[model samples]
Target: MAGPLPDGDQAPVDGLLSLEEIKGSEARTFHAYVHIPFCKDICGYCDFNTYTATQLGSLKQSDYAASLISEIRFSAQALEQSKLLPRKFSTVFFGGGTPSLLPAADLIEILSSLEQTFGFTENAEITTEANPDTVTFEKFAALRQAGFNRVSIGMQSGVQSVLDTLERSHNPENVFKAFEIVKGLGFGTSLDLIFGAPGESLEQWRESLEAAIALEPDHLSAYSLIVEPGTKLARQIKSGELAEPDEDLQAEKYELTEQLLSAAGYTWYEISNWSKSESLQSDHNLAYWMGQDWWGYGPGAHSHLGSVRWWNQKHPLSYSKKLEDKISPAVGRELLSIDTAKLERVMLESRTSKGMSISDLEQLEAGAKSRIPQLIADGLIDGQLAIKGRLVLTLRGRLLADAVVRELTD
Candidate 1:
């Protein structure tokens, strides 16, 4: 079993917000992140808050979705009464173990609830995450009719062997078919990929990138594989059933990815994300990297408004039960200190195409200014951009993005 809950994580029925502070909220965009934690098949490497059919025993999809919408209404009513329910949702994102697995009617019902409760922006960028195998022209068509304008499909790899090792259950061909279907239906699309799996080669990664580019997706997210503790993949590596990814090899692949994607006319906006154009960037995610606010609904979901952040109970049944009782289900929360918030800004802003101001970094720490010249001299950042009052990462710096953050924060 997992260890005892951490401090400030003892969840209560009315802990979502202090209620006293809701009227004073200055959050600009109320982005919605509805987490769907059910998956038909759980991937071996995944450590996300998700469960498969057997693990979910008696939880019905419809019931789960209904519980989510309940929280939506609950939060919306509170915000509305406080005159804080700004103009509809700026963006509504359905992310998860496989948001595609939810029945179309259930998805529409949930999304519609968000619209009815918070009101969707006139041009709200509604997006859903999907595994290629669960995608269908009919499903996407229905989604389009329901006001979803974007689909981020998982195209983890074009190589069969890599997919097999990762326990991913879709064909490379399925990725192409799904992309074509979403694009044909006029939905903006993004593809998700993972690199540095055990035994993966630079050549294989190159082919994977090549395959993804051929699809001409509006956005691409390539993440370095992480072997999270307590996961099957981590256990396998620990027990010698699988080889751990080589750090040096992973670095080389990151560099090559930068080269290939840049040549493909995709701008590396975030360390792992690339977009075809500024208009197609994931606005919901931009809210995150920039420290904007959003409200997450569902078991194990997280929410942030200004400096205060909170997450929900992790069990679906418990989450459902709490809403049935009409109580705030937030398990834990923290109010960020000014210093902590600035440090977070430096950490997140350093990884983006929108670079940070040197002055801002110095505000976090005076010594940060002294490190700038040395960082520039080390070629981690462009001297040109630095002179213009920004700290944009060089291709090398991006590969070492964490190091840059540490140096700045230190």
Candidate 2:
């Protein structure tokens, strides 16, 4: 179990504010995140707050759908009463263990509720995440009709052995089929690929990238395999059944990804996300790296209101039961001090093309600033990122993005 935070105890605030009160101070862009924790099957490597079909059961899934709509209604009522709905919303993201597993009717009802509760902007970037096995032309069409303009498909590899080793359900053909269907339907699409699985060769990793690019997706996201504590993958590593690629090898793969994607005309907008052009970037994710407010619902969903970050309970049944009992189901919450928030914003922005400013970093302690010189010398960051000057990561810097961010925060 995770230990207590730096602060000794967890305490609830006197009252929860309406969505308007939460978002009013942020002027950048208005966005929302909806978390769906249901999946047909659970991958062994996943550590997300999700469960398999047997664990969720059919009745529980139905109840979850209703509960989510109710949460939206409650939040919408709060926003309306406060008169704080923004004139426009830049993005709406439906993220999950496998959002695609939900039926078209269920998805349509959810979207309808959101449209009724908080109106969308004239041209909103609405996106949904799905695994290949769950995708279908009919469902894709229904999603488009329901206001989802973009779809993000997860395809970890182009090789069957890699998929089997990772315990991923989809094959390469499924990924290609899903891509073709989404493209034929004319929706902006993004593909996800994971590199450095145990026993995966550099040539195989390169093949995965080539396959993703061949699809000509509007956006692409690449991640290095990470073994989270408590995950099956972690246990496998501990038992000597699996081993991650060495740091030097992983760095080489990341460099190859950057070079290949950049050459393929994709802009490296964030450390792991690449887009075809300015318009193809994921606005909802940008809201996060830029430290903007967003509201979320469902099991294990997290939300940010200014410097306050909170997460809902993880168990689906418990989440629905709490909502049915008319009580907040949140399990954890944190209110960041201004200094901490500024430091986090700087660290996040530094990994992207938008860059971090010098003013943001100055808020850190003198010791933190003193430690940054070596990072600059190592090419992890370009000049001082004061609030006024935007300093972004160089290609070499992005390869060790997590390490750079950790040094700042730790």
Candidate 3:
């Protein structure tokens, strides 16, 4: 199960974003993240805040678009109340419980709401997450007309048995079919592949990567599977019906990923994320890793600006009721302290190809900074980049990213 929602009232408005944070001298990249909390099927390995259409009692799809737009309007009003000028959104991403499950018109209506309230950057990237089985070329065309330039397809595996084990319904061929359609329609396409699935072999993982690379997607995100507590997959493992994922095996697979993708000319911009080039990297996700501002809309969405981070109410019914009652649906928030912020910058930036600056590393305890030389000696941190004044990671470093973060922060 997902962890308990934080306990607190909606945070104070003044705590949302300071006038300075909102109107900084330097223009910050702004992003909009729209979450669609409904999916047609719930995969066994999953634990996201989502529901199927039938499970969503009283939350009519007909009323969903308007209610979502209303929330966007409320957000804009709040910014106005704080006397901050809203810039054009740098990127807009419609993530889901299967965003493609909604009609094309619904996606457009949400995009239109953003345009009316915040405008879009002239070269803004607009993307929607689509399950390979749920999208069509005609729908792609409608989405293009509605100004979406990218579609990220979930292609969990190329092996049928792997899909079955994960309880994913889409045929592997459907992934290539969706990719071809998106490319044919002149849209930027990204494929998300998961590795380290229970019962998955190293060879199966390689085949899945090769199949995805064969399609020549603009971007690729290879993530290791995490079995969340209370998920069907976790229970299966607990009951001995499924094998637990092997950590050492996953580390080997991660190295294999760097080799294969880098060989194909994909730049590893961030751990777990690669692109044909920097231009093809996900701008919306970069905004997050780079610690910029973004407002996430819809149930269970999270938003952040400067030090304040907050999330919306998790359930769609509760989310809708709050919006209908003209209230902020934010369930809780926390203000990041300066020390915590510095640590976060190091943690996020160090995982990227750009890495963190040398002087910035000096911000940590001397004992932590001293470990860099040893890290480089162990083939973890890149010695070349360290000499050039940045903390770029080696392929080995990425596999042990959590350990690196712990050494540097704790």
lDDT of 2 by residue, 1-410 (tens): 12122332242422265453355444656677887887877776887877887887654666567989877766565445555544345688888888888887887788778877677878888888989988899999988877888989999899889899899988999999999888888889999898888888888888989989999999999988887778887888789898865778888889899888999999999989999999899888888898787778777777666556777667778778767776666667777776777667767777788875554564553455665677788888776543236557778878877787777666
TM-score of each: 0.95, 0.90, 0.96
TM-score of model number 2: 0.90
In order, the Cα lDDT scores of the candidates are 0.86, 0.77, 0.86
The residue ranges of model 3 lying beyond 4 angstroms of the native Cα positions read: 1-3, 13-26, 364-367
Model 3 has an lDDT value of 0.86
The regions of model 1 sitting more than 4 angstroms off are 1-12, 15-27, 81-85
- Model 3, range 173-277, lDDT digits (tens) per residue? 899888999999999999999998888999999999999999999999999999988888999999999999999999988988888999999989999999998
Model 3 Cα displacement at 122 (Å)? 1.6
The pairs that clash in candidate 2 are 357-385, 357-386, 358-385, 358-386, 358-387, 359-386, 359-387
Candidate with best lDDT: 3
Worst window of 10 by summed lDDT in candidate 1? 1-10
Candidate 1's error at 43, in angstroms?
0.6
Residue 232, candidate 2: Cα error in Å is 1.4
Off by more than 4 A, model 2: 1-15, 18-28, 57-59, 79-88, 363-374, 383-388, 406-410
